[model samples]
Target chain A: MERLNRKERVAAILKILSDNPNKVISLSFFQENFSMARSTLSEDVTILKKVVEDIGVGSVETVAGPTGGVRFVPSLREEDRQSFLKELCESLKNKDRIMPGGFLYTNDLIFSPEITNKLGIIFASYFRDKEPDYVLTVETKGIPIAMMTARYLNVPLVIVRRENKGAEGPTVSINYVSGSKRQIQTMSLPKRAVKKGSKVVFIDDFMRAGGTAKGIIKLMEEFESKVVGVGVFIEAKTEKKLVQDYISLLILNNVDEEREIIDVKLKNN
Target chain B: MERLNRKERVAAILKILSDNPNKVISLSFFQENFSMARSTLSEDVTILKKVVEDIGVGSVETVAGPTGGVRFVPSLREEDRQSFLKELCESLKNKDRIMPGGFLYTNDLIFSPEITNKLGIIFASYFRDKEPDYVLTVETKGIPIAMMTARYLNVPLVIVRRENKGAEGPTVSINYVSGSKRQIQTMSLPKRAVKKGSKVVFIDDFMRAGGTAKGIIKLMEEFESKVVGVGVFIEAKTEKKLVQDYISLLILNNVDEEREIIDVKLKNN
Candidate 1:
């Protein structure tokens, strides 16, 4: 084994911890990799913890005692978060993004991995306290952000499809009225997707009346799982909502077809 | 400002580099943040570059000359890749994964952020030399994997939808035959998704006859862009394929519906 210096050891430790975020990494693992003493490894951790905090990108927390080690929890500074949201809102204000029938052309934004990954980290930071067992999303548009959130949380992502293809194995389907169009729609989940009593956090790209959010709650009930929280990238301002008490990163105040304008900004929550 | 020691500086540098993979970071940025001299930062980078390679998780490369510094490229060792694929194939061999048709239920696996994130790094490593401008995928099942790949590659993800939704702005739609069902289907992309003369990579969860891959090639041509490569998580073994030049992580030989058997293994490539 090569004897690594303090700089090399700290770099290796940071890489390992960042690679496996939210997972406890024991000092022995570092000791084995770097051929370092426990006390040296502890000093490296201390340095890492302080630097991470000062940077405001994330943090390293000590678990304490036996069977506990260090965990990396990713986070964004408040100013950084605000600036990102501001940039997103500015991009979304493009007149071309306003489609007919009050729909905002957010497909590009939602598909952009860089933006979605940041949004996922923000969502994950908010729910890190909840320690969700799984991140759930209705299929198609929401999968990217939901997958990132699940990645940060170190959990599986369960996607409920708008239609059930037999390839998903046995499934449970549900019907819910579309909150915006008031049209009846169906959603389905595979039988083996989630375990009973699993704590799930629902994530979606857009919430327009919260009908889909309400439907997900019912869908989770079929699996005997609980939805501890709901998070959406963009929630439209609505007079009535089928579901309430959800976190939204951005709010769509209005989409004026005649004026070709979209009013979107970061939510106060 | 607190003066960071060598260990603290190295840890902070590693975290920043890992967080923004493939993006060049100047030494001045580190110097400004860590309050370290240029020579010290350079030495730290050299140490990090070697340790990252020694670990086989990834590597840090120093870009020479002015306006350049360091870049982190994530990679997986052959042994780690083989073991991960072996475990994945084993889990896929579950009897319940076989559906009524020859389809193997892989929704849960593809939806898994951890698995998908790993797969993304593998795919990104393969195509990093190509320097793809965009990663593309069709809507529904392939979003999670594509999103992760795009994230690792540090590029935007452009999703082609199965149908023309007006919300996508003006889109260019194309007709292609589904390789499995032999049914004619429509796929569309917004006009603004990709720029002309851009390089693109197509990613998907599964490949039946490579029809979708072929369609993506044709769709990219519509934007005057080129499809540089196609990557699929699982490729069904077939004598005839619509597209031949592509990469697949796993080869799914056959699915015996009656016997409830699925033969899947990691591809040699």
Candidate 2:
């Protein structure tokens, strides 16, 4: 490859780092690929660090010593985060979203790539400090957001299935009570999904009574792993929650089916 | 924000464009945010286009008209895509991934964020020209990759569920035979998930006899939508497939459970 000038070098470097979020790239990689001196590449990285921060999209961090390199840590600006959540809440307030039994229809929003991508960045910002080995979620509704969180954190995503499949080989299945439905539900995972003594963060689309969150805690224990953090897109107001200490972007106060009204608000706004 | 010089402007533009893949950003956006003149921002974008292409990451395109703007079209270099698929085939060759019933235990790999992110980019590259309105997939395993594909294409992801949920409101459910198992199965989707005359691309993790893909086509027909493209991570060797004209990354020849061997190879390599 031909050597690039400072302008080209900075753009190339930023693109590579942003592509592999939170995963460090050795200095030698840039040196070998761009055929530039160490000092020159260092200057390009320093310039990139300021450029990214100036844009308020993320930060480019430089690690020190052996095995150290630079990585891009994605984050949303505080005001941007708040306004995004506000807009999300407004979207959820549509009366048409209220279904039978007062259930809120959120598949269109939660399954959106653009929204989930931002949600992933926000969730990663909150849990990245925990240095989780994996991002975990139950199958179906939560996979998209959890997958995004895992991508931003540069970690593998482990999905717990609703039922054990023959394709999963030997599995660990556990029955837990659903706080909202008050019924026994089963969740399963492959035995080799996570390493023992590893840390994982749980991400989901909704939290109603927090029964699923509590069940996740028990499921992690069976693997000798830990759930260090939990994040949800929406949390319904209930008299009592099965678990506490979880972050939610939106709060669902009421979904009146007969009245044809939906009331949702941004959490902590 | 203060005016940034050429190097800083180039970096910022690339970062923003990459963040919102396939979404056009008007020049006024940069003019307002970076406090730059139109000519200056245009020059920076020209340089960024060459830099990204030279690095073999993707291309930056400028749309000309009243609502003209620039957008990033992401693509993996041919060699990189081939090598990535080769490594994936190698990973699948692990004997431990074989289950008792000749099923491959691929939950770990298919659920991986890094792997699926790349797979999404590749799928988007192939189908982007179709200008899909939505990227569709079945529940459980296909959500992650489909979400990524939708992200890269800047479209909403629509997931088909195995069973209808009350929260989805009125849904359209259909029963189809599992091509491999030869048993009847059901798939459901919200009635409003797709607009009439919209084009969609189907993505999934594996295809045994293409029964599910065929089911997607029939389901889309109910909404008056069209299935423009189909992509999968792996395609198992079958006597005959139920669908044709689809792209697959890998081909599975055989899984010898008794001999503890797995035979897989890159598709069209």
Q: Report the poorest 10 consecutive residues by lDDT, candidate 2 chain B.
A: B1-10
Question: What DockQ would you assign to candidate 2?
Answer: 0.81
DockQ of each: 0.72, 0.81
Q: List the pairs of residues colliding in candidate 2.
A: none
Q: Report the lDDT tens digits of candidate 1 across residue range B1-269.
A: 37777777777788889888888888788888787788888888888888888778788988888988888989898888899989999999999777766667787788888788899999999888888999999988888888888988999998888888677678899999988779999998889889999999999999989999999999988999998889999998987999989999999998887777788888988
In model 2 chain A, which range of ten residues has the least summed lDDT?
A: A260-269
lDDT: which candidate is best? 2
Quote fnat for model 1.
0.81
- Give a tens-digit lDDT track for model 1, residues A60-130: 98898899889899889999999999999999999988766777888778877778878888999998888
Per-prediction backbone clash count: 0, 0
Best by DockQ: 2
Tell me which residue pairs clash in candidate 1.
none
- Model 2, stretches more than 4 Å misplaced? none
Largest TM-score belongs to which candidate? Answer: 2
